[model samples]
Target: MSSNRNDLDRARAAWRWRGQQRPDFAVTPGPGQESVWDYPRPPAYVPDSRHVSVYAGDTLLADTHCAMRVLETGSPPTFYLPPESVDMAQLTPSDRRTFCEWKGRAEYFHVTDSSGRRIDNALWRYPDAFDDAAPIAGWFACYPSQLRCFVDGEAVRAQAGGYYGGWITDELVGPFKGEPGTGHW
Candidate 1:
C-alpha cells in the first residue's frame, strides 16, 4: 500500500471510542429507542425495511423500503437507498469526492428539481466501496440538510454538523460525533 494509505490506516486506528462502552455524556436509550454510542467502530450495514423517502420541495427524489443503514460508533445512522428507488435523472454527477476508512472513496451528486432548483453535492455513493461496505455500493444517500427526508412517515432531522449525512429520527438517541466539542470523538 502507498504511504498515504498507510497513514490513513493509522488515523483510522486512532479513534478513542470503538463502541465497547458508552461515555457518561451519552444519553441512555429509552424504551424502543437506540443509542448511537452502542454502535460499533467499523460500523455495521443493517438492512432497513422502514419506509424512507427524500424530496426537494414538491419533487420526489427517492422512496424506498430497502435502505441500508450504516451505524457507526458516536454517530447516528446514515441511510443508503437502492439505485432503482432514486430518481437518477434529477441527479447530476458532481466533481466532489471524499474517502472513508471503512467505506472507501465516495462520489457526490447534485440534485436538480423540475423547477430548475439545484442543490450541489446533495447526494453521494461509493461506486467501488471496500468489501465491508460493498452492500451499499451504487446505492445513494442524500443530505437531509439539503433535501427533505423522512423515515416511517416521520420527518428526519439532519445530524448536528454540516459534514455528516446522518438522518435523525425519534428512535435514535445521540451525543452525536458531529456536534460541537466532539472533534476528537
Candidate 2:
C-alpha cells in the first residue's frame, strides 16, 4: 500500500476505534497512576500557559512551563511546549538521540532533579529544528506518564493513554508518535 493510503487507513481506523471505545475506558497517566475517562481538548490548538510533571509513585517528577493545544488526530489532541519551562536540574543527559526530518535532531535525558527525583530520559528536546518549530528549541518535554503535573503549585492530572505528551499541561490528550514518527512528517 502506498504511504498515503496507509495514512488514510490509519486515520479512519483510529476514528472508528475512538468512537467505539468502552465507556469504562481506562489509561495510565503516569507510573502506577491510572485514571478513568477521556480528557477534552479545543479545536485548532490554542496556545495557552500550562504546567505538567512526571512522577514515580508519589515522588515528584519534573515540572515545567508549557503550552497546551489540541491537534488533529484520530486518538486525541496533544499538547506541545517549550524546554526552558522545565527545570533541567532533575534530568541527566543520555547518549540516546534521534532526528526528525522536519524537526531535526533530538537529544534525550535521564532525569534526577535537584531534589534527587528520578525519571529516565523521559524527556527530550530538539537542539536545532526547522524555523516553524524553532520556538520550541532548547525547550525540553516529557511524556505524561513519565512525570506528574503541578500548575501554579496545584496538582493536576491527564487523560489515560500512552500516545500523548501534555506539553504546557498535565491533562494532555493523545495519540503521539515518538519513535518511528520520522520520515517526511
Q: Give the number of the best model, judged by lDDT.
A: 1
lDDT of 1 by residue, 90-176 (tens): 999999988888888899999999899999999999999889899999999989999999999999999988998998889999888
Please, what is the TM-score per model? 0.96, 0.51
Worst 10 residues of 2 by lDDT: 34-43
Q: For each candidate, what is the lDDT?
A: 0.91, 0.49
**Runs with alpha carbons beyond 4 Å of true place in candidate 1:** 1-5
> What does each candidate score in C-alpha RMSD?
1.6, 8.6
Clash pairs, model 1 backbone: none
RMSD of 1: 1.6
